[model samples]
Target: MWENKIDINQIVEIRAKTTAFFGVGAIKKMADVAKNLSSRGIKKVIVMTGKSSHIKTGAWAVTKQALEANAIEYLLYSEVTPNPTVEQVDEAAARAKSFGAQAVIAIGGGSPIDAAKSVAILISYPEKNASELYELKFAPDTAVPLVAINLTHGTGTEVDRFAVVSIPAKEYKPAIAYDCIYPLYAIDDPALMTKLPAEQTLYVSVDAINHVVEASTTIVTNPFAILLAKETIRLVAKYLPVAVKEPENLTARYYLLYASLIAGTSFDNGLLHFTHALEHPLSAVKPELAHGLGLSMLLPAVVKEIYPASGEVLAEIFEPILPGFKGTADEADKAFAGIRNWLDGIGVTSSLKDEGFDEYMVDRLVDLAFETPSLDGLLAIAPVKATREAVRNIYTNSL
Candidate 1:
């Protein structure tokens, strides 16, 4: 048996750097926030977004209205996709450079916001490409300024400085953490999420739940972060189903958004484990699979896999939200089943096989999980060591 290696009473150092504007009709404050930007040398900005959701949900109109009202000349770039690729970020940088974009307004879900942050980084270093930016080829003197409008409740891209960039050519997806990518300010309006579809709402909420699970259980665990994770899980549990059942429930949307934000803060301080490490490769390889969907499919298996070493407080953290959950040796197994069942209750019942995963690709997924240097830090921080055979077994089980 693995020794009790995690320090349950570890000292905490929390770092929260983003300034946030949140409430109903919060998007209306964009003009005022942009006006604040002019004092900091921000003139023109790029409004980065996905293709249809903004238009379909009316978020695009609010974004444009804000820029125009402030006379903040902005370019609207709507090419972002789920699991945003490095090449796409490079394209956004090119647009920003051409338009002389002084700041970025990210106005969608995690993908667009993540792409916007990466674009801000690539623009600050005009001579380098996105890949080079990832390579840290040059030290940036200053980050290109940014404001994020979070239109989704998942990923918490608005609250953090990390950007997940994928390279299709090599099937690589790596998270980039730099001070420059942190939004100077963020707008998270629950009103915006009211129009979101049930699938998106539930899936993203699961993403937040997954964040709490992985962050709370990592070897870098801390008491404060676990406190945040426990509350986050409780909030997600109470609010997610209501949000799914009633998409227009502003109360549920507001609290779920808060849950995601708290989860982001927790993970930022305590970091993540191999659940996220394992999912990044799935999205990198498949591209069609959404991040949250992949997490839902993999979390049950992952919780069971890591339970042997990480189960001490997991039951306590989970019992508050998981149905019929008991804090025992089998608590991890029960918790995993409860979470998987809860996901099904919210209409997230698809497996990796249903998402086009093949058994033959297990080796590829395993290689990316254990072999990719981009994912090494997360795996290293895992409560249980991630071995080749172990990772392979997890991948196969997830299939």
Candidate 2:
């Protein structure tokens, strides 16, 4: 058994592009965060979040109290939802502009944080709409300051510059990664994550797992990504089941939150490939589908096809679950089988068919994969050539 070495009792300050505080009581730093923002001439701010995660998790009271204590003015935009739409961001940006919000405070998971990033941009440039920003019609060079109070153990938008927004009308879900989008201040308090439902817990950790897997094996793979990916997988393998079984286990939540953060940093440095490229379209079409579940459904098939190109690196990273892995091209089956079994053991056994997809949708998904903006960029980085035939075969095997 692995020993617990992380000191979750002490707040650790992570200084990356985004200054982050992580630990049990990290949310208490909201006062300091507010004061710092206030000192920066940011008197009026916009708080962006999902419908009720902030209130249900008790993060809202603390954050509101902090802003009030600092004598800062704030407006709340609570319409963000899972797979946040471009319209939601545009509306929030318009409201923030009308309120003269000088900065943005995003509280919740990736959906709200991602929306907040786009809102910040639109607030700065009232001339551009969400579509213009997302479609890259205009390259935004600056945005209003952002503070992220992350409430989940996945989707490391807290510390990363990437954000994903969807246009369900057009079935487009693309990602944006700009240096300006990194939050000015961020908090990840696992205490807030204990109430996350079991399925979401599993799905979010799966998202983190996907982050590292793609980060470690991409064409741009590097030592930093490899090291972080190995630890990310190790922590998720050890702690995800425990967190699922014991929902209020702080230690389990602590490590999983750490896993998610480093996983974010890993992919930020090393980039991603097949899984994200394909999963975006799935969730884009089926707005109810969780991003993590979509990625899990496609992972085994992707690993099978891509393993040969980076077998040694992948084998080392997945060694915990895929024991006795030989890191050879011939062991591709073992690599994917081990991953598939591990996913099943973790209660993520859903097939694409179970998610209301069928063979009929395969062709449409394939076209979306190729047509979606920024996805071709992801596919271009696959270690193996991502030909239409290869993409079609992977989707067929997934089904």
Candidate 3:
């Protein structure tokens, strides 16, 4: 929900320096960028990818191309997991250092890209511990040139300067936000996403939708963000199912990818709210749930919880974007109902219980969530600060 009281500091200064190359077959452009960066005297690139079957579908080809061209010495950290741990990043950083990498290339979904960002920062600031980096308290002056090749339309880790890394030592995961973390180039090619299964595709789209909705509804609202959020919702509602059912549909895949980028840009500026805050701990606790599914389970309930606290602002914002009501109780219900309907349409379960969660774990989950800096960040932006009891209640409702 948007309020007219725009905080000048919250007015994000968007710069247009990063190069975004998008197309149906844009993976081909990766070679061109690699060659160009090589010719421009870049060498020793570190490539971070996941071990998933989906990642292998595209990354192997790209890695082979880079190898054949001998354009740059490459280091491959392919052991990245779904919710990447800090130790994984430390190991990747070690590999980057051993390879004398001057730049970083991330290929896969958010996991690898997020890991790569942390690794890139470690390349320059090798002495800084992962905990320090995750805290966002340490600001590094330099990071390796990073190029992101996105294979999923999810976290928007490719375009955003923020990287979310899970620290097992601490009870929380914090976003490492820095200007240097922004990828030097982003390649969103739909061809790479053709191998994504229906469930994966739908799940990632739900993740992207959360990004849009959370940022769109948060306290520090922007007009551009609202527009992006509306478009993201429309695109997800329409194309997510198409892309899921017909994985080979390049057009749907392309739209999903573009929508993800736009959503990422919006959240990069406005940041996320309670959904992300609540989801992070679930992933940390039950590593199998996956971040997207965690958010999917919590989104609707969190929105309902926050709606009453920010009623007027939300009504004004949703009146035009959400149809079937005149910004009244009916409108708000329709707006949230539309989200639930879409989630159902995409086959996302809205209850954490459906995802194997229960009330018994809520207290521990709440404790872990509060440890997250992003939770605090989101709380600061929330219409109503989520108390321990409030968080427990939300979790209970989600279950």
Residue-level lDDT of model 2, residues 30-51, one tens digit each, is 9999999989988899999999
TM-score of 3: 0.89
Q: Please say which candidate is ahead in TM-score: 2 or 3.
A: 2
Compare the candidates by TM-score and give the number of the best one.
2
- lDDT for 239 (candidate 3): 77
Backbone clashes counted, model 2: 0
- lDDT per residue, candidate 1, 1-399, as tens digits? 121352312322223788877666667677778778876767799989998877876767877776677677888899999888888999889989999998888888999999998888777778788777654455554678888888899888788867787888877787777777778888877888888888888789888888888888888888878998888888887878888888887778877988888888878778887778899889988898889999989988888778777776677667655645445656666766776786777789998899998899888898877654458888888877778877776777777
Residue 26 alpha-carbon offset, candidate 2, angstroms: 0.3
List model 3 lDDT by residue over 1-399, tens digit each: 122243212213223345767766566666777887787687788889887643466655765585459557777778989888889998999888888988888888899889998998999997886777887768886788888888888888888987888887665777767888888888777778889878788789889888877787788978788778777777776678788788888778877887898889888767788888888888877777678888878876776777766555455444433554444443444556666676786687557877777888888898877877656878668656778877886688678
If candidate 2 were superposed on the true structure by all CA atoms, what would the RMSD be? 1.0
Estimate the lDDT of model 3. 0.76
CA deviation > 4 Å runs, candidate 2: 1-5
Q: TM-scores across all candidates?
A: 0.92, 0.98, 0.89
lDDT winner between 2 and 3, please give it. Answer: 2
